[model samples]
Target: MLTKFSVTAAAEKFMRRVVRFSGLPSSAGFRLLVRTGGCSGYDAEFSAEVEARTGDETIEVHGLRIFLPAESRVLLDGLKIDFIETPDRSGFAFIKDDQRSVVAVSADVARIDVSAIGRG
Candidate 1:
C-alpha cells in the first residue's frame, strides 16, 4: 500500500544482469523483503520474482517491476536500492535516505584487520 522506496539506474542495470546470469524471464522482477537479526537491527532480502503477490506494492522503473510486501513497507520506506562497484567489492546496497547510511546485504568482498589476527 505504501510506496516510498525507489530503484536507482545502477540497480536497474544490475537487475538486468542478474536476470541474464540467472536465466530468469525478462518479465521477472525483484522482491524486496526485510527481516530481523543481522549486524544491523534488520536485514534486507532480495529475490527474483516472476509475478507480484497479493498485497504487494509494485514500483515500476525502466520496465522493471520491484515488489515490496506489505510487511516490509514501513521498514523499507525512503530507501533506495543501488548497485555499487569498487575495485575490491561490488554488489547491491540499500541506501537509507533519511539516515544517510548504506546497508549491503550481499557483497563480493569482506573487510579484515590483519593486525587484529591472533592477538589477545
Candidate 2:
C-alpha cells in the first residue's frame, strides 16, 4: 500500500510525544496496529515491537520509525494523529482523509503550531 503520503511531521511528533508520555522501555522500533474494538470494527493500538513483520511497511519520518502491517497500511494512509488536552485531561486524537468525525479537529494540525506544550 505504498502511497505518496508515507507519514507527516505532525504524525511523527505525535509518536515521539507518546513515547515520552508512555515511559515505555526503549527499543529500536515502534508498532502501530489496527485492532478490532472500535465502533467501526477497528481500533488503533500502539506498542513496542522488537522487529517488523514481513508484511509490514516501515515508515521513517523525522527519525521516528513505525511499522504498520500491510493490512493496516491501507486504513492508516493519509491519517494523522495528535494529542489533545481538554479540561478533563490529555488523550490522543485521530484524523482520516475521508471525512471528519465529530471529534475531528476539522483543521490543519500543521498550522496549529503544536510545540513541546499544547496550544489552542
Best candidate, lDDT-wise? 1
lDDT of 1 by residue, 46-89 (tens): 66677888888887877777788877787667878777888876
RMSD of each: 9.9, 8.5
Which residue runs of candidate 2 sit more than 4 Å off their true CA positions? 3-11, 17-27, 40-42, 97-120
- After superposition, the stretches of candidate 1 with alpha carbons farther than 4 Å from their true spots are 103-120
Q: List the residue pairs that clash in candidate 1.
A: none
Quantify how close model 2 is to the true structure by its C-alpha RMSD in Å.
8.5
Estimate, for each residue in 1-120, the C-alpha lDDT of model 2 and write its tens digit.
573234445556666755554444444466776544555445556654556778888777766667888666775557655555556544345566456542332222233223433322
